[model samples]
Target: MIKGIYETHVNVRNLENSNHFYEKVLGLAHAYGQPERGNSFYWIGGERHAMLGLWEKEPAQVQRQHFAFHISLEDMKHAVEYLENKGIATRNFHDDDTGELYVFGWMPAVSVYFTDPDGHSLEFIAVLPDEAKPELGLIPWSEWERMHGRGV
Candidate 1:
């Protein structure tokens, strides 16, 4: 059987700044990293972690890369507010293909996309419902588990 996720690696331009963002801003702990290797790693929850590696290049070298983290509705709301107050820009999205996409009113698994201080595209998403909820935007994990699978 599968155990669990280990870590996801991402490249950064500034290891120090990325370290600060993941630690102070995201509240993740710095597990271990190698400056000589041009990489920094942050411990997320438990065994799960995220790696930030440093790289050097020109302007066009900055490509758009994005990853999403699942958060609860309340957390999502607070995060949106926090980012907005911090001057982080966020935009709303809608899907035309309801047959394939999930939505949660204004709350349907809301997502915010923005660049980190390093110009990396980072996204936070609250999972949306398979159907549109005009009033509520919360899609419980139980429902998602049934729709997707176990362990999600």
Candidate 2:
């Protein structure tokens, strides 16, 4: 009944900081926004499509939310390293069997999770081809890249 996501809105403590994070760190282009309304808009995926709106609000009023951005498999790897170089930490789904964080095999996607300046949970996810299945259990991004014969 529903199509793809058209836009997403989230409250942020500061528009400037959020803008820098989204624009510089996440590589989203700034579309446009109303300065009077204390809001900023970013373009994701394509130009003038898949919008992400940031509304400036008080810290107490900012509600934490989770959202995942679809990225290329190679880009996902670079994103993880990029975040690490910037001193940002990432996490994956916890695997009880291996006692480590691993990717979700069912969806065949490798994801790295982190938080925004406003404490909203965000993820960079790369969905792989259906044939890319693991033999034993969920694997890490490194393992996924290695199995596909591509990595840094």
Candidate 3:
């Protein structure tokens, strides 16, 4: 049976830029690289936990992708600023740079999104320790706290 996502891949136009973005900006450790083959590999959430593959391809050949990385709730709370300070713009689920984390109430998870050098959509998310509220759909974290009768 499947356990969790072990790896995911995305296409980038320039392997160097993508590597710098994933390694320096995102802090994913380099796992391997094949410069002649235009492929790069990185480790996420530490070695052997998860992997991300970046393959350099022609602009017309690249197919953009969207993926998320699991993090702790505390990190999710500061993700926006953390990214923005690194010169990456974080956006809401609506694709707006509102500097806020939205909760998918159904799973009661918090997520914030940003894009890589290749414009591939990437997200940092964490599951909240609360009951599911599917009816709530997607809402800001402040709203979720208020609904639970607590101050944000």
Each prediction's RMSD to truth: 8.2, 3.6, 1.4
Taking all chains together, each candidate's TM-score versus the true structure is 0.61, 0.81, 0.94
* lDDT by residue for model 2 (1-152), tens: 88789899999999999999999977899999898999999999989669999999988989999999998877865775787787677766661344233567667887778889988999888887646465636777566667668653
User: Which lDDT values do the candidates have, in the order given?
Assistant: 0.58, 0.80, 0.87
Residue-level lDDT of model 3, residues 1-152, one tens digit each, is 99999999888999999999999988999999999999999998899999999999999988778898999987876788899899987788887656556889999998888888887888888998899999989998888978888644
- Looking at model 3, which ten-residue stretch has the lowest summed lDDT? 93-102
* Per-residue C-alpha lDDT of model 1 across residues 49-149, encoded as one tens digit per residue: 44443443344555756666666655765665677676676554442222222334554465556667766777667764445555645444345445546
* Cα shift from native, residue 73, model 3 (Å): 0.3
Which candidate would rank higher by TM-score, 1 or 3?
3
Query: What is the alpha-carbon lDDT of model 2 when measured against the actual structure?
Result: 0.80
Worst-scoring 10-residue span by lDDT in model 1: 94-103
